[model samples]
Target: MAVFKEIFSHCSDLVYRKIEIEGRQAYVIYLDGLIKTEDLQNHVIDEVLARKQVGQLSVEKVEEEIVTVSAVKDQSYLEDAANDILEGNAVLTIDGHNKGIVFSIPGYKTRGVSEPDSEAAIRGPREGFIESLRVNTSLVRRKIKTTNLKIESMKIGVQTQTNIGIAYIDGIVDKNVLKELKHRLDRIDIDGILETGYIEELIEDNSWSIFPQIQITERPDTAAANLLEGRVAIFVDGTPFVMILPSTFWQQFQASEDYYDRVYIAIFLRVLRLMFVAVALMLPAFYVAVTTYHQEMIPTNLLLSVAAARESIPFPAIVEAFIMELSFEALREAGVRLPKTIGQAVSILGALVIGTAAVEAGIVSAPMVIIVSLTGIASFTIPKFSLAIAIRLLRFPLMILASIFGLFGIVVGMVILLIHLCKLRSFGVPYFEPVAPLRFSELKDVFIRTPIWMQNSRPDDFVKENKKRQANDLKPSPNKNEG
Candidate 1:
């Protein structure tokens, strides 16, 4: 521990304040900014120093009076004291004693609860996660007050010492899943982990895969929902996004509000989103394939119209498609980087202006513009922004293949993608869930959400031990005789 402290002595963020009271010197230590100054002054320091009666300052008495003190029954070791300081809990050490008190006055400033930017819902709790880990955990705890809601805290990243919590319902969560999650996290020997993404990269089943195996969301409700469903959530101290482990391909398309809305509507929307994903990922490639090689596939009239539109264009079909796709991607990127107020306007306007100018200048054809626009719109339907971005990226390679070898290329690309998806896993669970493994019952909640009563079990992919979500006979039927 001393060696660790010596190594980080030069770190500007590390703070240690030597405090002396009544000829007895003590060390008041904490990570700067991690603890509140006012609490330290009023609750800890004031109470300790203002002990007017000298006869009553024994260790037991000190433990009794300090209101903000966390642990009194258990003995506090130097290692625990150091850990407390690292985790934003202030520690006060008396001169002679090896033990100390930890005050849980985490004072780090964080963003106030606001609607999640990515997983926004028209109805339901608008609160999203903040940078502070305690506050975020509190939000989740506020929703789930069960004793089974276990939060196993671990500090990873030797240098950063970031607090990461693996939270789940103890009895409901599969023991194997929990063990695997812990094993992977323990193996992550990085310098620092500032965000959940860092841990995701380190612990993910397939690091090389483009698809994200772990689901990350800013919404606490989403994390809480997963926790209830027997999936473990990994929370990194500084990041708004909390990662849910054992993510299946179907889960990425799911939004938090699905359970809140009408079951029929939810099912419809889920199906729509799935359709949109397919369209988003393959539409551009299919367009390029048809226009460049499979001209016969298009109706004669349609082909003539497409050819007439492309007549003024000097570039080949593939070149024209690439130009439009690249421009659209650039516009999307710029819009995202810009402030939200003008971002949408800029992206929409830029696409309109650029697409019009390019078509007029004979750089791209009209049919290409329609295909790219549809593809962009389709990609937006994806609930997860990261997944949508991945689809957008995959489009380029698919388009390139289509340009080179047409429909055959598109088919080959999809086959390869499917094979890769099959190979990928999330904490050892198959990534391409219900579809690949063919869990017919779970499909009710995957491709389309079944009516709430019908979804009698949690996803079996994540937790094998506790599969039942509710009961088998929860269907609500009207009394025909009464009616």
Candidate 2:
């Protein structure tokens, strides 16, 4: 008891209740705010007191039958027991015995599972991951529903002692990837990991790169789908988002809804997403380059209108584009930070009002407004937020290049970007997999979604053994009788 107090620094909320158990002195210790009061009273205290007649059998009964919890363990070390007590668990220690029983009964409130605000699904399940790690693992387990699906857990942070789980399939997951993942995780010597992003930063291929080498998703279906594709998932305890490992350049453009929608619809949406990603990255730069240097690229009438619009503005084309882009970025950040109900209204109204006011005030050309708006829309078409952010970040550099060297600068920036992407790797797998390496066989689900039957194999770059995801010749055929 004195040691426990010393460890917790005599915190008032640290609970320690001494009582008789089997006629020997014993005590139950837990944190006040961490535990369920009703559960402790009904399951532990009341049950122990009610079994007073059991006499010498009380400790035995408590260990064997009395406490009605799914997880109960006999712990030996004080440090382990203390850790459990701090983690919303109850520890019963007898006076004479050094060993104690630890009960798992965490009961602090958490937000209920609801539709993810960031990754909204139109046709698929509306459920999203909650902050609770156990709940999130349960969600993944529910989707996989196989004995082969495994979740290995460990404590990460030194002070925080945050629980982190590595989820993968037993036979399907690449042994090399799993080993490498565990190696990286074991090598993480950080004090705390408040979110999965911390782990991602620590374990991902490149921290300085703008492109996300790992994918993050709140949807269990997406995580499960990736797991089935011979990937690994890292689930952080407190955060709603889970990180999927070995994410490629193309994977960032994919979404759960792509699999949910019809094949043709999915293909069309994917092509649009690919097109828009380019637009989002290059549109402002293209506009700046054309207006400032290459007037012939635009139709004569459109160029005249653009010239007329910019005539009243004091800023150059590049300066006008920068001002509008920065303003839109500010508005986007404001919209995201504001309360959800008013966020959309503020973003839409703020953009429209600001754009109109800026054009009327001759602060920016109307053509700049149109270009910025189009760029923003194109960015929104991207399915992954991390990738979208990376694209948004690349826009400024590309715009600067365009301003300095016009079309030549834009082309140079793109070449550099592509070269960097091609050079990057996620855990030894190329970031621009199948595309850069030119695996023609694995292109079935890249820019377009072939029918499920046609996608009979996983990407050759991902797994060594399980390259075949499904059997051959599963494509549907018309019956002879029908024909």
Among these predicted structures, which one has the highest lDDT? Answer: 2
Candidate 1 has which clashing residue pairs, if any? Answer: none
Residue 132, model 1: Cα distance from true site in angstroms:
1.8
Residue-level lDDT for 110 in candidate 1: 75
lDDT of 1 at 383: 92
Q: After superposition on all CA atoms, how large is the RMSD of candidate 2?
A: 1.7
Q: Which ranges of candidate 1 are over 4 A from the true structure?
A: 1-22, 30-32, 66-83, 479-483
Tens digits of per-residue lDDT, candidate 2, 1-483, equal 778878989588888888874667778899998888888888887777766663543455677878776678898888998889878899988776668888887888899999998899789999999999999999999999999999999999999999999999877788998999999999988889899888888888888999999999999999999999889999999999999988899999898999888998999999999999999999999998998899999999998898899899998988898899999999999999999899989999999999999999999988889889999999999999999999999999999999999999999999999999999999889999889988888888888988888888776666778778788989888877853
Model 1 TM-score, 2 decimals: 0.91
Q: After superposition, how far is residue 368 of candidate 2 from its true place, in Å?
A: 0.8
Predict model 1's lDDT versus the native. 0.83
Report the CA-based lDDT of candidate 2 relative to the real structure. 0.89
Report lDDT (CA) for all predictions.
0.83, 0.89
